[model samples]
Target: MGRKKKKFILGIDLGGTKILMGLFDRKFGLKKTVKLEMDGNRGEKFFFNKLIDGIEEVLEETGSDLSDLVTIGIGCPGIIDIYTGTVKVSSNVSFFKNYPLAEKLKAKLRVPVFIENDANAALFGEQQFGAARGHGEVVGVFLGTGIGGALIINGHLYRGVSGGAGEIGQTFLSIPSVSDFETTRLKVGALVGRNAIASEAGFLLLRQKCPHLLEEIGYNVKKIRSGALSRAIRAGDTALEDLIRSRSRWLGVALANVVNVLNPELVLLGGGMMEAMGKIILPEVRSGIEACALKPLMKALKVVPSRLKDNAVILGASKMACEILKMTQK
Candidate 1:
């Protein structure tokens, strides 16, 4: 009798500022990982090259080759055409408009490739192995450079027509103005995303003449990331904390609306911003939901942070890849 060969899949989570790749066995155990900075401003060639480099590095580190891989899955921060493996448009990475990423990767590696929106992947990961395990209805909202959302209904991913269903960040809200009868409307992303927090913090620091933060990050708005912002808060930057709380409350309101509409069984929050500042932000989010969401819905809903942390997307991608492989075999 011959020994059974090991099967593995490559799962890649491509974010706005970082690219994470993991090699996983058939049971979804991570065997190796590679992380690289993603420069979205650099254009498609640079991005593609970096992705290829990361994959090769992981394969080399794990003592594996393309022939040993079963399939490749990518979770990208963009609007994906899942049926065709094309990226219709990506707000975070502007160069990927109408890009046939799956076809390109398949042609290069001679392996089946699957691509999905990052938030959706994360949700799947959570449902399969993380916080939302065993839940049939789940909604995942990831707070990063921009907020991303995904929906799982009746144990299946709910990708709407055109694969653009879970765009919670783009949902707008109208608030009545104090000075007039008119109401002001704003996109949820503009009010609660990481960029908004960073912008507000930058303005506060500048106005308060706080040189420490500017000095720490070379006074570059682009460089003011979640870690920097968290450090600032930990250093007793009251203004920054206040700004984050205010924005997080609005995020909660946005999520409250989602909970009301979807009536999901579980709501999972993840991404860099949440991972870094969840302790500070989650309370406000909970409060906002309590204030706005239907009482019965709130009673049944479980709002929790992602247990898988940073690996949620990659694991989800791996699961998707494995499922695709099974389908092909069948």
Candidate 2:
């Protein structure tokens, strides 16, 4: 008789707007996945309840309740304590403040629970199972509402003393400006959410150039995405090209700083805007890095697009769960 397939762990990627759950085997391959709305209400009560509902649904759908799973891993959009499994602060999801997330989930499910920052989890997931799979040292940069980065060193994640290392997007790029007094001030470039500027700028440019798109998409052009901007750029829209160019310049400079610091074997770019702006932005980013970076290290790294796409975080959470299980057993 063939050996039976083993039971798996559960991985949850809880973002600001969505909750994605997946069942993964020991090897971290996803057996099944389920997505549910975040239902961003007021406080912890509503958020936890919504999470409970989603977990129950996934367990039911897979016919594998919490008792059968080895452990659970969660990725939340905030500052987290990987050692204590606590959520410290959250920008987009406010209810996560000081929440004992791992304890609460453990009590409900009666299983070991691990928590990590969503960005770190996503980076780990991509390195283990997605874009940076083959490399020993890798940096994963996620550009969306904000920039998030994860670094893998010697095939293991390098979580700094505070477990908050690799926040590359927060790296500042100073642009020199001269005032009437001849004193110079530096204007920081694009520190806001990458998606925010892309969507907003893309909408404005589209409104000026492609009013027909507004008519076709019901003028809900505010809902425009980075891919749509790329399509417009390819279609020879001058405004769209210019908008991408501007974002690319800012993003390139910021990433160049990150490259100079980490000097990882590879840099994997993921998130909403990367797909649209990657091709146009990476060359310029490389140029900026070469212009500014240390000569020897500048030629060593390669930046590329993510292979797993949107599924990176979910898979990473699952991989984390598997790792936690290994630790517990030892």
Candidate 3:
């Protein structure tokens, strides 16, 4: 008789825009995947319902009963109490505050469940199966609607006091509360987290200076496609090109400070903006690091794009869940 196939784990990546779930075998090969849109306006009832629905769909598609699964890991956006499996606050999904997602999933699914911050999951995913693999100290920097950062030290996540240690997106460029209130610079998240900022912000900052080369964003904001702005740059839109360049400059400024303090050996940049505009942003960011970073520390560091594509979070979640299960078994 043929050897039976080992059942795998379920991994979920829950974000503001969508929820992605996947089933992976013992080898971590993906067996099935599903994605669901999060209609933010519909409120919490619909959100949770859709979330469960996606899981159910994947379970059915993979032909693996919930009982056959080893464990489940969910990477959720926002502040979460990892020890207690509670979601403290999620700017993406505001309804959940100190919600015990792990306990709730365990009750309903009747399986072990582990929950982690999305960025941390993504960082771990990359470390275990993607870009930063072999590195002892690494930083995952993702630039999306807002910036997200996760720290991995000595091959383990560094969850500081209160599990909110890696909220790097909230890091400020300059508060400027002391003077020049009008010229005061606000972080990208503060200016553009709610509404689509890539086009609006990029246009407003660049259009008037060079209107003859390109028009404004043209209302392509509905789809939430970040690559469009970068696509414009590649197509030779001077305004957007300049905007991306400046953004990278600021990115360097912010990241240089990170390097000075943490001095991580590797920094992997991911998320919508980095994936879309990497070519434009990388040089400027590197220049800033070279200019401002401490010589010895900066020399030892390397920044690169993440290699996991879109599966990093899910894969990382599965690995963590599997590890937890093994520890419990021992």
The candidate that wins on TM-score is 1
Question: How would you encode candidate 1's per-residue C-alpha lDDT over 2-58 as one tens digit per residue?
Answer: 754747899999988899999999889999889999888888888889988998899
Query: What CA root-mean-square deviation does each model show from the true structure?
Result: 3.3, 4.6, 3.6
Off by over 4 Å in 1: 1-6, 175-185, 209-212
Candidates ranked by lDDT, best first? 1, 3, 2
- Clashing residue pairs in candidate 1 are none
> lDDT per model, in order?
0.86, 0.71, 0.77
Greater lDDT among 1 and 3 belongs to: 1
For residues 1-330, write the lDDT of model 3, one tens digit per residue.
975554879999886677889899988999999988876557778877897899889988877677778899998888878777899987787668888989988998788999998889999999888999999888887766677779998778987888887776677777546555433236645433323345554455444533322343453345435666665656666765666677666767777888888889998887767777778777777776787888999879998888985788899888988887888789
Error of 3 at 256 (Å): 1.1
Give model 2 RMSD, 1 decimal: 4.6
> Model 3, residue 244: what's the lDDT?
62
Alpha-carbon TM-score of each model against the true structure: 0.93, 0.83, 0.88
Best by lDDT: 1
